[model samples]
Target: MSRTILEVTDLRKDYRQRRGLVSMLTGQGRVIPAVDGVSFYLRENETVGLVGESGCGKTTIGRTVLRLTDASSGRIVFDGRDITTLSRAELRPLRREMQMIFQDLDAGLNPEMRVRDILREALTVHERPSDAEIAGRVRELLEQVSLKDSKLANFPSELSGGEKRRVGIARVLAVRPRLIVADEPTSALDISIQAQVVNLLRDLQKNLGLTYLFISHDLPVVELVSQKVAVMYLGRIVEMGLAERIAHQPRHPYTGILWSSLADKQTTEVTRRVTNVAVERERRTWGVFDFEQPTSGCRFAPRCPLYKEKGRPAICTDPASEPQLRDVGHGHVVACHFA
Candidate 1:
């Protein structure tokens, strides 16, 4: 197997609302727990999909991992180096190896700069490139993202939404980053354009050997490109397993509901098949998890459909010890109390 390129352990980031004079006087200051103890791994050339609803900490996790936003706590190990505490000067050289594709293309790109200038600036930031070399690299990066190098001379306004994002990607690729923190790469794209970008990313991963932390709320899109999938809810990964396995059999309720799009195969099948699958689980045990530093018994208890009167799931585990990810064969690792 390829070496692990990125490993995040108990990563957490909190966005706080500073108390205004009025709120501070009234004592209403609150810190939004955006990313609370989310963890996963991204191997070389592997795509790990992070899916959750808006405000579930998916994008915050991506931004924090790449250091676009400083993390509140937890370790971020990349390429065998701990970057969480590296000073600005120390982190400068390593910046070239890690890149990000922003959710808002125009927001990240300078409106004052043309496409060529945008790509060229990235090259200049890292080192002094000859004019000819800079121009050639710009053209190459544009082609890598399936855009004409001629578009390089155009302004951001001259391109479509998809094309603008492609340019943003081109600028990042121009730096030859080994790991990409892609924040909703296709969110602004139309359905047809979404597929094109997804396919382009898949192809680029194979060619460049790039590992990705693909952040999105769309389950189907995440399923298409990721080898492993982690479901996040209110800043915690409630379920994590192989993409295909988790798609087929989700051990967590949040996972089951969020997974309907990608893993609804058994769910949409004949009623008998679904009954047998759900009933067959009675013979086995599953693991369980309780989010630390919360105000309730289970964060999902408020919305869970199968939750019982006494606060236990109808078809779930209640293990007393911390759960371990165990293979149910076929590379599926479920973190439930019963398993």
Candidate 2:
């Protein structure tokens, strides 16, 4: 079995919201739990897809795990080393081992610098490679990401969206990172370009033995790239299992609803059946709820179809009975009272 490369335990990241100057002065603010007690692991060279609706903390979890953002509480272990409390100096050396692929096409690309200069800066961040070494590595990175050497002279502003994305990826690769947190890497691209980038990512993973925490709302792409899929709702993972099982045999109602929502966009017979089974009981309006004033039990209870189908069970609403993840079978885990 491959060694576990990253392990996160009960990770929680909270943001405080103060309504007015009075509240701010008085130090009174509502705490919003962006990532609430999330836990998962990634094996070496494996991809684990984190899928959910917008604002469900998929990106927050990705950032927190990389220590790009600090966690409010919980442990983050990378390569069997606990890095949750590492200072900036201590983390500097580890930075080369991990990196992020941001959602923005021009995230790390400097508008003032040409593509080659940008890559050179990244390559020299942790080491002082000689000019000859830098030249060789630059060519290697361009080949690895399938970028033309001629484009290296163009600034980020002069490049197309796809080219900018490729340059951003090349910059990350310059550091020779083993773990990458890809935050919606393909969401900003055109359909044809999206397919190309997806294929490129898969190829790079296979050739370089990279591990990825792939975060995206595109269910089909996530299923295609990930070995395991974790379904998140209201900042919590309600269901997680093998990608195939999570797609075809979801135990949690939220998981079924997520996949079925994708079915609405595509007219496949298999997805149609999934849509019918998942949303047939979904009659309640999905009202907006304040994160600060969370529901008593399950955070997803307000929108959960199963809660209504089960005749509004009191345990689901009981303050002391919020469901926790429990193993079902075959490594599948769900956090539903009736799953």
lDDT of each: 0.76, 0.91
In the range 89-152, model 2's lDDT, one tens digit per residue, is: 9999999999999999989888999998999999999999999999999999999889999999
Candidate 1 per-residue lDDT, tens place, 1-339, comes to 999888888888987778788568868876778997777888999999988888788888988888878889999998899988888889888889999888886866888889888888888888898999987887778779999867877899888998998888888888899999898999888989989999999999999999998988777778788999988877887788788766667776557655542333434452232333333342132334343334443466545544543366533433233344456676566554444
**How does model 1 score by TM-score?**
0.84
C-alpha lDDT of residue 223 in model 2? 92
Top TM-score hit = 2
Range of the 10 consecutive residues with the lowest summed lDDT in candidate 1: 270-279
> What TM value does model 2 have?
0.95
Superposed model 2: Cα runs more than 4 Å off: 19-27, 275-278, 281-285, 288-293
lDDT of 1 at 134: 86
Clashing pairs in 2: none
